[model samples]
Target chain A: MTLEVADLQVHYRTLKGDVRALDGVSFSLADGEIVGLAGESGCGKTTLGKSLIRLDGRMRHVGGTAVLDGDELPIGDDKAMNARRWKEVSIIPQYSMSALNPTRKIGKMIAELLRARGKSYREFKDELVRRLELVGLTEKVLDNYPIELSGGMKQRVVMVLSTLLDPSLLIADEVTSALDVTNQRAVAETLVRFRDMGFVKSMIVVTHDLSLVYQIADTIMVMYAGRIVEKAPAETIIKSPKHPYTRALIGALPEVGLEYGDERLQSIPGKPPHLLNPPTGCRFRARCPLASEECEAEPPTVTVEAGHEVSCWKAN
Target chain B: MGRYFRRKLLIYGLTFVIAVSINFAVPRLMPGDPVARMLTRNSVANVESSEAMRGYFNELFGLDVPLWQQYFNYWGALFRGDLGVSVFAFPSPVATVVADALPYTLALLLPSILLSWFVGNALGAMAARNKLLDNGALPIGYVLTAVPYMWLAILLAWVGGIILGWFPVAGGYSFALTPAFTWTFIVDLVHHWFLPFLSLFVVALGGWAIGMRNLVIYELESDYSNYLQALGAPNRLVRRYAFRNAVLPQITGLALQLGVVVGGALVTEVVFAYPGLGSLLLNAISSQDFFLLQGILLFIVIGVLVFNFLADVVYVLVDPRTRLGLEGGQS
Candidate 1:
């Protein structure tokens, strides 16, 4: 495994109380694997991605251990994590359009960042130019300001910059949500190409578009409130999801060849529960059609096959 | 860039034309007649002689002509670099009067306006992230900004001039000395200039500090700053970028605040009795010296416009986004 996250609990510190954004979540990524983490807007998938690399100010790492390549990550300590960031682990944040400094030239900003990190920009210049070209960009973009580039160009530039150091793990957070369908497909394919080229060992693609992530992810992990409801191969998760939440989630998507002339598409009956002071037992119990008294207690992660696991009482 | 500057110059030229026209019209529209006021100051009581003097004075000042002709003459004299003669200080040309007062005002205005902007932005940027400085300095800044220019001038005068006797409260220089290029006169000029400058500086400092603090905080929280921090760029590097970006808005703010600062300086000069354009303006208004008033107002208008133009140029140089907008062809 390239990354192993076990019993991770991250909380959001608010004036009201500590919001259990990520409560006892656990997952692992294999070498060269790209895992698509999918869920609704507040499902804590972004939190999971951020926690692995850099937790924001409001997020507190209550309990967790993320071991990468047999070395424990200092997830809670910012100073300790700084040494490993960008070089060991990096993130392609959601706001790639405005990620660059508008005042500084792209090449100069990159050089300054490199200098601060004790790396020589001149040494990396040729490789950087190659990667920019790989993403269908010219080296002339480095001389231009961020404002001069189109949104798609800026997005591609950010992609090249994030993986420039060949980090072991990359977290691409909703990177495709802002792009059009064609650009979205191109970006997703570019991510796979990066992996194939050994630019990144593994990646967690956190997104809400199930159909989109299904195209490139090796394995899909479906999360409900703050916990993963199912983990299976991409084909199995899309074709035969064991968890009701995952099934309903996949059911909501409109397929290419389907006709909905007579019947309307189905949506889940209720929204996910509020993470702050969440109800005891299964998080999806309130919204699950198959909910029963057995679901009042927490369901264990039961293995259906060698690699497939489902956290549901009816999965047995 | 050439087209952009040409357009700016065209706008400024139009503004000048409109402003000069208004400057000519305002004093004429006022209730008092400057020639009659001049007569009263001379204490010419006899009706026959007063009437003779009025006719001679009006003809001499070119006021005896028709209103349209007078307006043309006014513009004609302006183009010839003549500001006409002051009714308040008879026989002295308005240009000479204004010229005499110009240096004192410039000396007081330049250092105060620039130093406040620089020092305030630095302090505000520093205090944005430091809790102790923010808590301590922000409230003081608020209080300082809330204090009116004249009120603060009076307060400084009372404390530094009356209570302590550390500095002179009035005049551009000591009355005991003659005007000269010697060190003693220069020292006395500065000593008298200090209180008025301080009053303008203190009030403006507060406004700039408050503006910069808020701007820096916003920039630090911007997506670019967050991206840098997430990439593990050191705090210093991130803050340096934030400060640079934050200063862009403050430049525009400086342009917007320039008129207000100039107005404050005017009030400050009046309160301190400093021999600057403000005091000259007050005398012109009270004595109904139309030519002197017009001359002083024209200088102020031109000063404001030139400074605003300089700000636009500086903004274009510092912000690439604005530069792109100016070029108008790029994405």
Candidate 2:
């Protein structure tokens, strides 16, 4: 395994109470595996992705151990984690529009950042140019400011910069959400190319657009209310989903091959539970179509097949 | 770039014409006669003598012409580089009087504005992340910025001049020393310069520090800064970028505040009784010297316009965003 997150719990501190964004979540990524973390908005997918690289100001690492390649990550201690960041693990953040400083030239800013991390920009210049080309960007972009580039160009520049050091794991948060349809497919394909070219050993592509992730992801993990509802091979989860939440989530997607003469898109009926002082037992029970009285007690994550796991009493 | 500068120059020229016209109209609108005040000061009680003197002075000062003709002549004479003679100090040309006083105001203005900006920005940047400095320096900056120039000048004069007797309370230099490029004259100039400069400097320092503190904090929380921090760029690197971006707004603020600084300098010079443009302005008003007042106001208008232009240039140099705009490129 390249990455293992065991019982990871990250909560957001708020005036009302602690928002249990990620409550006792356990998952692991295999070497060279690409896991698509799919969920509805505010379902802890973003919090989970951010936890692997960096926890923002409001997030509190309640308890967990993230072991990457036999070494434990110091996720809680921001100061100590600096040593692991960029060199071992890196991330492409959500706001790529304003990622680079507006006043700085792209090349100068990258050189400064590299110099701070005790790396020589002169040595990496060739590789940086090569990777920029890989992302369909020209060498002239280095001389330009972020504002000088088009939105798509800026996104590609940020994408290249994030994985320049070839970190073991790259957590891309909504990397393609800001793009149009054509650019979206292009950026998505670029991500798979980067992984195949060994720029990253493994990856976690976090997105709400399930179809986009399904194209590049080896496995899919569906999260509902900060806990994993289903984990299986990408095709298996889409075709033979056991959990009702995952089944409904896949059902809502408009598959291109399906014939639907008069059928409207389906949406999950109820809203996800409020994370602040959340109800006990299964978080998705209230929203689950097959919810039972047994769901009042916490359900075990049971293996339904060789590699498929579902956290529900009915699945057993 | 040249086109951009040409457009700026055209705008500045329009401003100059309007400002000069306003300066000409203001003093003439006052309810007083320059010749009457000039002749009365000589105490010429004989009617014939007073009338002869008033006529001679009126012609010499161009007041004998109609308002339209005088306005045209003012522009014509300005093109010829003649600012008229001072009625307050009759024999000296307006140019010479202004020249003599210009150095003192510049001395007070330059060091105070630039130094306060530098020190305040540094202090504010330090206070942004430091708990102790933020708590201590923030309130002091607020109070300092709130105090007006006149009140602060008087307070400084009382405390630093009268109470301690550390320096002379009034005048630009000691009575015994004349204007010369010597150590004694320079020392006396600095000694008398301290109070007015300090008053202007302290008052302006607070606003800059507070503005910079808030700007730096906002920049530190901005997406770029957060991205840098997330990439594990050290705090030092992250803050350097934040400061660079934060200072861009402060440069624009400096341009907007330049006129206020000039206004504050006038008040500060009045409190110290310094023989600068401010005191000269007061004397011109009392003596009804419209020519002298117009000349001084003209100088002030030019100073503010030039400084604002320089700020525009400096902003372009420091901020690439503006530079791209000037280059006719979209950002």
Candidate 3:
């Protein structure tokens, strides 16, 4: 296993109270595996993605032990985590358009970043150019400013820069949301290609678009109300999902050529529960069709198959 | 680049024409006539001599001509670098009088504007993350920015001059010495200059601190800074980037402040009775010296426009976004 995160609970300190964005989330990624973390907005998928690498201001890490390749990550301690960041773990942020400094040339900015991390820019120059070409960008882009490039180019540049050091695990948080359908596919393919080439040992692609991730993810995990509901191989999650919430989530996506004729596509009946002071039980109990007395007590993660895990009483 | 400068120059040229026209129209708007003001300035014994003096002054000053001809003559003389003669000080050219006081105003304004900008930005950038500095700098910056420049000038003059008697209250220098290039005269000039420069510096210092403090804080929260921090780049690298970007807007503020430099802090000059452009402006207006007034106003307008142009060029060089726009327009 490349990354094994157990009982990771991260909360947001808001004016009202703590928002339990990621409560008791446990999962793991094996070597060279690409796991797509899917959910609705505020489902804590992005929170989980960020927690693995860097927790931004306002995010309080309540409890967690993330072991990557035999070493334990200091996820809660910011200063201690600094020594591990970029070298062992890196993140491609959601807002790629404004990620790089606007006033600094792309080359000088990257050089300065590398220098600050005690890496020699001169040594990385050849590989940086090679990867730039791999992303269909010419080396001339290094001389240009962020605004000089199109949005897709900027996104690709961020991708190459984030994984340049070949981090053991890369958290790609909503990397494709800002892109168009064509660029989305290109970016999705690029992530898989990067993984195949061993640029990143393991990857967690966090996103809301299930269909997009379904095409490239080796395995998929669905989350709701800051809790993971299901995790399985990509095909199993789509073709034979046992959890009621995962089934409804799959039902919401329109088939390639399905004609509704008179009936509309199905959507989840109700909203996810509020994370702050969440109800004590299965978070989706109020919204699930399979909700029963067994769900009143929080469900436990049970292995239904060799690689499939589901946290639902009905599914077991 | 050439196209950008051409467009800028065209705008500046049009502004100059309109401003000069307004300057000419403003003095003529006053009830008093230039010829009449000059006649009364040095009274003659009887009506006959006064009438004779008025006729000669009208011919000499071109006031007897049709208004259209006078307007044309004003432009004609302007093109030849002649600002005409000052009636307030008969036999002295407006250009020579302005030259005499220009150095004093420049001396007071340059060091104050540049130093305040450099120190305020450095202090503000430092205070953005430093809690102790932020707490004290915030309140002081607010109070300083809120104080009126002229009011501050008067308070400083009273306390530093009248009560304390540490600095001279009026004049550009002491009455004990004459103007010279020697060290003694320069020391006296600096001594008299301290209070006015301090007042101007302090008032403007507060504004710069306030602007830069807010700018640096906003920059610290910006996406670029977040991305850098996430990558484990040190705080020094992140802050260096923030400061460079923060200074862009302050450059714009500097250009705006330069407009007031040539005008020489009118109220401050009046309060100190310093012989700078501000006091000269008042004397010109009261005595209806149109040439002197027009010359001073023209200098200020030109100074503001030139500084604005410099700001544009500097912005292009510093900000690559604008440069990309320029290049994108062509390619």
Candidate 4:
């Protein structure tokens, strides 16, 4: 295992109260595995990705232990986490288009960033150039400002920058959402290529587009209301999901060539429960079609097959 | 870059022409004639001598000609760098009087504008990082920015001059000594200059500090800053980037502030009775000295346009986005 997260709980400090964005979530990633974390908006997938790298100003790490390659991460303490970041763990954030400094040339900015982290920019310059080319960008891009590049070009630059240090784990948070279908496919392919080239030891690709992630992810984890509802091999999760929420989620995706004719695609009936002051039982109980008295109490996570884990009471 | 400058030069040239025309028309439209005012000030007792003087004065000042001819004559003299004679200070050319006072205003305006900008931006950037300084500086910045220039000048003059008697309240220098290059004269000049400069500096400082504080905070919260921090770049690196980006807008802000601050400097000078362009402007207006007023107004218009142009040039040099726009139209 490259990453083992146990009982992670992260909350957002809001004006009203603490919103439990990630409550009692536990999962692990194998060496060289790409786990796609899928969910609707506000379903703690992004929170999980951010938790492993950097918690924003509003997020508070209430309780958790995430050990990456036998070392416990200092997720709650920003200062302590600094030494490990960019080298041990890195992230290609969601805002890649505006990620690089607008005023600085891309090459100069990268050099400065590397120097600040006590790494020699000259030593990395050749590799940086190589990686830029790997992403189909010319080394001339280094001399240009961020505004000079197209959106997809900026995205690729950010990807190469994040993984340049060869981190043990890389989190790509909504990296493909901003691109068109063609660029999205290119970006997705680039991500898999990065993994195959050993640029990142393990990865968590946080996104909502299930069909896209299914193509690249080794395993898939579905989250609803701050908790992971199912974790299994990407193929198993898509074709034979045991959790009712996961089944409903997969059913909601419209297939490429399948025509609806007269009937519309199915959607989950009710919204996910509000995370602030969430109920005592299963988070998806109110939204699940197979809710029963057993769900009123917290459901126990069960592993029916070797790699499949489900947290629903109806999962047999 | 060439096209951008050509466009800017054309705009400034058009503005100058319109401003000069307005300057020519303004005093003529006023109630009293400058030649008549000069006659009354002289108070010649003999009617024949007074009539003779009036004809001579009107002809000398070009007031005896047709309006169109006078307008053409005004343009003709203006091109030759002749500002005609001042009715308020008779026989003295308007250029000579303006030259005499230009140094004083420049000394007061330049240091105040520059020092305030530097110190205010530094203070605002520092305050954005510290809560204690922010709490105190924010309200003080608000109050100082809201103060009128003359009001603050009067306050400073009253407190520092009348009550404390630490500095002189009026004039560019003491009446006890003539203008000289000696240390004593320079010291006395600075003593009288302190209050007006302080008033202008303080009022302008507040606006810059407030603008910069908000700008630095915004930059810190921007996506680039967040990306840096997430990548574990130190606070120093992040702040350096934020400050550089934040200062770009403030450069443009400095250009915009020049005209307004010039107006404030004039008012502050008048309040302290400092022998700068402000007091000269007052005398010219009250005495209806058309040539003097027109010359001063033209100087002010040219000054504003030149500073704005310099700001555009500096902005292009500092911001790559604008530079790219200049080279390739748009990205």
For all candidates in order, the CA lDDT equals 0.90, 0.89, 0.90, 0.91
Give the alpha carbon lDDT tens digit for every residue of B211-295 in model 4: 8999999999999998999889999999999999999999987887665443336677778888888788888999899999998
Calculate each model's fnat, 2 decimals.
Answer: 0.68, 0.76, 0.62, 0.71
Q: Model 4: runs farther than 4 Å from truth?
A: B259-264
By TM-score, how accurate is candidate 3?
A: 0.98
- For candidate 4, report its TM-score: 0.98
What TM-score is obtained for chain B in each of the predicted models?
0.95, 0.94, 0.96, 0.95
Please give the DockQ score of every candidate, comma-separated. Answer: 0.77, 0.79, 0.61, 0.76
Over the true interface residues, superposed, what is the Cα RMSD of model 2? 0.9
Which is the leading candidate under lDDT? 4
**Chain A accuracy of model 3 expressed as TM-score:** 0.98
Best by DockQ: 2
List model 3 lDDT by residue over A205-262, tens digit each: 9998889889888999999899888999999999999889889999988898878889
Cα displacement (Å) at residue B191, model 4: 1.0
User: Ten-residue segment with the worst summed lDDT in candidate 1 chain B?
Assistant: B256-265
Chain B only: TM-score of model 3: 0.96
User: What's the TM for model 1?
Assistant: 0.98
List A-chain TM-scores for all predictions.
Answer: 0.99, 0.98, 0.98, 0.99
Model 2's chain B TM-score?
0.94
- For model 2 the TM-score comes to 0.96
TM-score for each model: 0.98, 0.96, 0.98, 0.98
Q: What is the full ranking by DockQ, best candidate first? A: 2, 1, 4, 3
lDDT of 3 by residue, B1-331 (tens): 8988898899999999999999988998988888876666676768999999989998888788999999999999999999988888887998998888788888888888988998888888888889999898778988988887778789999999999999998999989899989999999999999998898888878778878888999999999998888889989999999999999999999988886689877887898888889889899998889889999998999889989988999999999878778765321
**In candidate 2, which residue pairs clash?**
none
